[model samples]
Target: RIERLEEEKKTISDDIKDVFAEAKGTGFDTKAMRSIIRLRKKDQAERQEEESILDLYKAALGMV
Candidate 1:
């Protein structure tokens, strides 16, 4: 079962590679785009956590 899952994962991964190749053919930098996407998600999550903490602090101070 594990072997089958691994094979499926490889197949899916290859399909993704093919898609990325096509994207690159269209002049897209897949690697940089992926990095940007990861960074954006990380930054967004951090900002969200910061906002949540600020909200909690305001509530604690009876300002919210």
Candidate 2:
């Protein structure tokens, strides 16, 4: 069962890679897309907290 699940996971990973590759071929920003996907996985409060911290760090670095 574990091996089968691992194989399935590999297949999904490969599919994601292919999608990213296709997006890249079309001149899409895959890294940004990945970040958006990651952010979407978080709840609104979690996202807000992360964004707040990021803004603070940017301000500290004078990037903002």
lDDT winner: 2
Candidate 2: clashing pairs of residues: none
Assess every candidate by TM-score.
0.58, 0.91
lDDT of 1 at 30: 99
* Model 2 Cα lDDT, one tens digit per residue, 1-64: 9999999999999999999999999999999999999999999999999999999999999998
**Candidate 2 weakest ten by summed lDDT:** 28-37
Off by over 4 Å in 1: 40-43, 47-64
**RMSD (Å) per prediction:** 8.9, 0.9
Tell me, by TM-score, which candidate is best. 2
Give the residue spans of candidate 2 off by over 4 A: none
